[model samples]
Each structure stands twice: as structure tokens, then as C-alpha cells.
Target: MIHIRKSGRDDASGLAAIWRDSVLATHDFLSRDDFIEIEKLVCEQYLPKAEIWIAVEDGRPVGFMGMTESHIDSLFIAPDQHGKGIGRQMIAHARALAGILTVDVNEQNVQAVRFYRHMGFVETGRSPTDDQGRPYPLVHMRLGEQRPTDD
Candidate 1:
């Protein structure tokens, strides 16, 4: 059985390990250096601001998902854990915390795009580039029904 729980600073190493492994397994996308950078940035800044959740199976952390008020900072599962509903569970948890949840998927990450679509997040818009002028295409997605309170 998989159990989900909040992660604290002690979980940083676990999160970093998961992040590196996942990125390396996707050799079609991230280079090792890029994954390292992401691991550092997420652990140092993003995860701290967000609610970080870890999926533990038999006492071992197998996946994690992080969310802030306006965005899903990260969602990653072990390579062996894909297609096992962990991602869905994480998304559901994030949605429960916010009336509307948002996330950005790189245009090049086709698997992630499909996964987000399956979770009912729509392509509301796109961003042109990364702050450093890298031409990375970002697809924005939002969840929840439209309400009169939407702004």
C-alpha cells in the first residue's frame, strides 16, 4: 500500500534522489546537469514555499508532489512507479487544497502534457520563454469549474 504524507527538510535528500533519477531516465529530455540544477532549485526554494507530499510504500519514499497556492511546483514518481496512480493522487491532493490549481509543462515534455490532460487540466495559455531568454515553451493548465468568483 502507498501512503502519502507531508515532507520536511529531512526529506531533501530523498527528493533530490528522486528528481535526479527521473530526469536521467528521461534521456530524451533533460541532461544530467539540467536535472541537478532543477534538484537544487526545487529543494532550496520551491519545495520550501509549497506543501510537499511524499508517497511511501513499505516505508520507502517512492514519489513526491509539491504545490503552492497558485502552482504545482513539482510532481515526480520513481521510474518504476509510473502508471500506478501516484500522480493522480498527488494532483487530487493539490486540487483539494486550492479551488483552482495551476501548473506549467514544458512543450517538449509530451508525456507530461498527456498526463496533465488525463487529469482534467486544460491548456489555458502559454508563456514565451524562460527568464534567461531560453526559448522554452510553457503550457499553462488550470483545474476546477469556472465560478463567478474567478478572476
Candidate 2:
């Protein structure tokens, strides 16, 4: 059985590995050099500063999420563990914590967009680049709120 828990300092390496594997599985649009650069940032910067949650099964972390306030900064499940409801469980947990939730997903990551839509998130806007000013576009979404209608 999988359970959600807060991460510890010791879990950083394991979680970074999961991040690497999950990105390789899902983020096919990333260039090789970009992947390596992002991996370093994740390991050396982002993961350390963010509030993270882990999905553990059998005492091992199989997935993780990073959140800031009501926004979901990142979420990744072990590639081998996909379609097993771990992502869903983590989103549910985040909703419980933050009330309303928001997330920005890469436009190229169709699978993640579909999952968020299935969880009732609606597109609020779009950006021409990701947070890091990369060329990957982002689809901004919000849950538990009515989508804005153009006047």
C-alpha cells in the first residue's frame, strides 16, 4: 500500500533519482543537454528549496511532488508506477492541504495535461515559455473555480 508523507533531507538523492527517471519517461521533448542541466538544478537547487511530498510504498519513495502555497510546482511518479493512482492520490492530498489548487503544466506533456483535466482543472491562461524562460510553453490551470469567460 502506498502512503503520502513529508520528505526528509535523507530522501533527496532517492527523490532526485525518481525525478530523473520520471522525466526521461515522460518529457521526451527535452534535449539531452537541457535534461542534464535541469537534472542538476533539480538535484542542487529546486528539490532542496521546495516543500516536497513523497509517495512511499514498502518504505521506498515511488513518487514525489513539490508545492508552493496553492500551486503545484511539480509532480512526478516513478515511470514503472504510472497508471496506479499515485499521482491522483498526491493531487487529492494537495487539494486537501491548499483548498483550491493551481498548476502549470508543460504544453508538450500531453499526458500530464490530460490527467489534470481529468482531475477537474481548467485552463486559465498560457505562457510562451516555462518558468525558466525555456521555449516550452505552459498551460496554466486552476481547480475548484469557474473558468473565466471572455467578455
Candidate 3:
């Protein structure tokens, strides 16, 4: 059975690998150089943050989610694990911890946008560019109407 648990310092490498592979599979919109830069930040800075969780299946890590307060900063599952409901389980875990979950998904990623929608997240707004001012747009979404953020 798959389980969600707090990530440890030792999980950084595994999580980075999952993030890299998952992004390469689903985020084709990203430029090659952009993907490289993002991976560096993820390995060197982001995964060190404590509010992260991992999905373990049969003694191996397959996915992870990074959060801050109620916002899901990132969520990625190994490409091979895509259809196994791991992402749904991860989001449920986040909701349990934060009450409600918010996420910013790449607007160009139709699958991710649809996935979040089916998971009960609704779009609140859109940004012309990502947080770093990259040309990639973000679709901001939140779960239902609980504690909504004014868009």
C-alpha cells in the first residue's frame, strides 16, 4: 500500500529525481535551460524546506508535495506512477494538514489543470508570468470556497 509521510533530509535526492523526471515528462512547455535552472533550485534550496511530504510505495519514494501554510508550492509524482492515484493521495494528505489547499499550476499544462479541477480545485485567477517573472503563466486555484483568497 502507498503511504504519505513527512520527508526527511535523506529524501532530498530521491525527491529531486522524481521532480526532474516528472517535469521532463509533463512540462514540455519549459525551455531546456529553464528546466535545468529549476532543477538546481529544487535540489539546492527548495527540498530543504520542512513542509514537504513523500509518497512511499513498497519501501521506495514515488512522489512528493511541497507546501507552505495552505499553499501547495509543488506536487510531482514519478512518471511511471502517474496513473496509480498517487497525486490524489498526496493532495488529500495536504488537505488534512492545511484544512484547504491552494496551488498554482502552469496554465499551459492542460492535464494538470484538469486534474486539479477534478480534485475539486477551482481557478481563482491567472498570472501573466510565474513568480520569477518567467513567461510561463500560472493558473491560481483553491479548494471550494473555504477561506477564499480574493483574486
Highest-TM-score candidate: 2
Model 3 agreement with the true structure over 29-134: per-residue lDDT tens digits? 9998999898888899899875788999998999999899899999999999998999999988888888778999999888899999988999999999998999
Backbone clash count for every predicted candidate, in the order shown: 0, 0, 0
Which scores greater on lDDT, model 2 or model 3? 2
Model 3 worst lDDT run, 10 consecutive residues: 142-151
Query: What is the C-alpha lDDT profile of model 1 across 12-116, one tens digit per residue?
Result: 788778876776665356555666676677768766666889999998889998776758877889988889998888887777777688898877778888999
Q: List the residue pairs that clash in candidate 1.
A: none
Please give the ranking of all candidate structures by lDDT, highest first, separated by commas.
2, 3, 1
Q: What does the lDDT read for residue 67 in candidate 1?
A: 74
- The numbered model that scores best in lDDT is 2
TM agreement with the true structure for every prediction: 0.83, 0.94, 0.93
lDDT of the candidates, in the order given:
0.79, 0.94, 0.90
